[model samples]
Target: MTERFYDQLSKDFEEMVSWRRYLHQNPELSFQESNTAKFIADKLRSFGINVKEQVGGNGVIGVIEGNHPGKTIAFRADFDALPIHDEKNVKYKSSVDGVMHACGHDGHTSALLAVAKVLNNHRNQLKGKVVLLFQHAEEKPPGGAKFMIEEGALDGVDFIFGGHLATDLPVGKIATRPGPVMASVDAFKITLQGIGGHGARPHQTIDTVAIGSRLVTHLQEIVSRRVDPVEPAVVTVGSFHAGNAFNIIADSAILEGTVRAMNSNVRQQIESEIRAILDGMKVADRIEYSLEYIHGYPVLVNHKEEALLIEKLVKETISLDAFVEKDIVLGAEDFAYYLEERPGAYFHVGAHNEQAETQFPHHHPRFDFDEKALLQLSRIFLQLANHYLVTD
Candidate 1:
């Protein structure tokens, strides 16, 4: 193989940019990706690949079976956008109000589409099957990955590959590592019920704001003293809502937050401690409260063989400098759901462009990525397929 496997596909690369801009212009939010699904299915059909729509709540699957028989591997791209509004000044800025592809899912979708085109042209040169997963609702809880798996997305699949585009890293690099690269998250919501009264009647009222404030302060101890020092854990209280008027005391208060941990045992332990702390809470005035914990994505652990394969291929196809060892991140991803069942590895494609000042982090309104990074992504996918599909 040549240095760049896709150097011959320059026109397609340009078209990929067009596709990225179009998807960036009109992004759809989690789980409601009808237009996005239709667009992907139509594109896959145009390339003569087999398409299956609505496999799992707007997820579309494309199948490319080679002439010979080999392992069945899956490559996935999440097409769901975030709830934030776009704030960039580019001409192809998001037209949809209050919804944007701030996390570079548009770029991921574009790269995967271009990859399908390249693989189709060279279908006679390979063995085995390639399953293209166009997943939805990755940004929201009850991730679409779980739904797609339930709907048979991974049926007969041997291995899987997925990646996120990181805007903090420059466009030329790729990031990968083995074992728990990202954290597992558990989100909690607490509602405190108390008696409301006028500001003048302080003695007659139970102030929920006071109770919630104390609870939030005390919850921090779960991470500091309860969890082991060697284990990484975090409890962040993101939102607290209570009274509205200046003089009227609110009868109830709501607190919402998230807990993150890298290890499963620590995850369960931290959660148990949280429950115990709230159960042991004492107040001068009797108050009632309710707690709800929602299990989210598990820790993203890369398979040893898959990660080593990608790292080796990246050095050969790209440059040795392009391969980076990433530290454990507290952020969560639904891709972890796929890894929970199969042997797969998740990597990151760098999208940071210093000259363009597109360095803002993901999920921010001003978040942007280097579109050229998609070409690197396309090449990586093609190389992986070439190696995995070889029957000899």
Candidate 2:
């Protein structure tokens, strides 16, 4: 029965490609995925799956119940695009300006939709229920996963799984780890208030630009000096704004950056070090500063058993060499919220292809992945479903 589903999915691969390309051309950003959500709900309904709309903001859920009783499983795919213009020269390039499916969310959606179609068709021959989570706002913090979970996306789910198309890895390969697969993301903005004066005078002005520069340098030390050497952490200052003119010593300057860590202790330590450094600078320079630290997604730790199951299934369903034990990524994912609530694993399907010019990193304006990855992702999800649910 599972083999029959795989054959059906292979036959419907073109439909999946059409869905992905259509989404890529008409991309929407983050929480503003109204049309995208509608498209997803419409597709799921067309597959004969029961659709639920407006779930936790723009999230969409589809449920497919089987004939026999068994363990229920949930699968997730994010449907949000990034705030980047489509720079690809392809015909399917984004029609929306300054917004594109730069992170392969379009591909994720299309793949899962294809899986939903096949599974729904074989529902009579299967056991247990399948929940499809068409999540929104994955690129934005306070993500759609949290909201969808709050609204009971995984109420009776026994296990959940999600995957991303990795343009960095070669096509047809898959990778995952047991725990700490992705980092926790936190952002900070430091505003320095000082007296403005001419640039020529050294003593008259408080020199906020100088202070901000010092802060940027000091923040890097938090990861290198304060955090334990064995622990993985990062503190990056992405922005610094001081003055418009070169001849003026700016009265105020702002420093903005992000912090990434694998665990809570290291995350807290980085925040503490940042505050301590700022407090010291304040006392010595007589400068008043305000720091705003915002916590984003938590670290994505894959469940040990679930992750190993994926590794085993990848080898059995695809090939022995298809599974890769990938190193932990510092990138943050909102799917971490789902794993926190349910036993699950988030893995990556390689989409990079040399001849297809699809090796660009995610979130880049020219970012794209080999569409073949859509079928690969669908195959993995089907195998996972078939493994847990009884098939005729």
Candidate 3:
């Protein structure tokens, strides 16, 4: 069954490419993928699969029930693009201005769509059912996954799986690791209030610029000095705003940044440290301030058994050399929300092709990956589906 599915996927490779390129050219932003959702639903319906639309804000769900009874397996793919201008000169470059599928969500969608076609074609031979989650708003926080789950996308799901196209890894290879594969994403904003005055009369004003500068420095120290060296963490001050004029002292200053940690304890510790630093600044600098810390996605922890299953399937289905045990990344994935609810694992399919100018990292304007990675992704999802629906 797996061999037949692989052969069918190989034959449908061009069709998959067409789907991917079409989506890449007409990319849509997170939470606003109405037309993309329609396109996906229409394709699934054409394949004779049961389709559900407008799920959790533009998410699409397709289900295929088998002739025999067995475990229900779920697969997920995000379809949201980023807010970046297309810079690549390819013929299929994004047609939308100031918005592009810079993160390979287009590839993700096309891969899963191809898999659904193959699975739906062979639905009678399978056991139990297969659920395809075409998710939205993965690039933005409070992602569509959360809402989709609340709407029962995984209501009957026994095990779930997801994959990403990784430029960091070479093509024909895939990678995964059990436990905390990605960090928790959180952000913060600090506003400092002080008295505005003439630059020459420095003593008359609290000088928020000076205080905010010191605040940035102290914030950096949280990861370096406060958090344990063995524990991986990051604190980045991405934006800072102050006075417009160089000669005048600004009455207020605003600083915005992000924080990442591998574990909940470390995550909490960082927030506490930030608050403590703010308190110290208020007492020492005699300035009023506000700290707004926004929590995004949680750390992505792959289930040990499920992750091992992916590694094994990659080695057996693809070449043994195609399987790579990767290290934990600081990047965050909203897929973490699914794994938290159901037993599952998320892995990366290598899409990097140095000879094709496709080595740019994700979320970059020029970012792209070898389209051949789509076949690799579909192969894995098909193998996973067969493992649970047939072999088990």
Highest lDDT: give the candidate number. Answer: 3
lDDT comparison, 1 vs 2, better candidate: 2
How should the candidates be ordered by lDDT, best one leading?
Answer: 3, 2, 1
Q: Give one digit per residue, the lDDT tens place, for model 2 in 1-392.
A: 66897899989999999999999999998899999999999998887889999999999999999999999999999999998998999999999989999999999999999999999988887789999999999999989999999999999999999999998789889999998999999999999999998889959989998888888888888878878999999999999998999899999999899999999889988989999999999999889999999999999999999999999999887899999997998999999999999999999999988765698888899998889899899999999989998565
Candidates in order, TM-scores: namely 0.95, 0.98, 0.98
Q: Model 3, which residues run further than 4 Å from truth?
A: none
Arranged by TM-score with the best first, the candidates are 3, 2, 1
Candidate 1 Cα lDDT to native: 0.88
lDDT values for all models? 0.88, 0.93, 0.94
Question: Which residue ranges in model 2 land beyond 4 Å of their true spot?
Answer: none
Q: Supply candidate 3's per-residue lDDT for 272.
A: 97
Q: Compared to the true structure, candidate 3 yields what TM-score?
A: 0.98
Residue 282 in candidate 1 has what lDDT?
A: 40
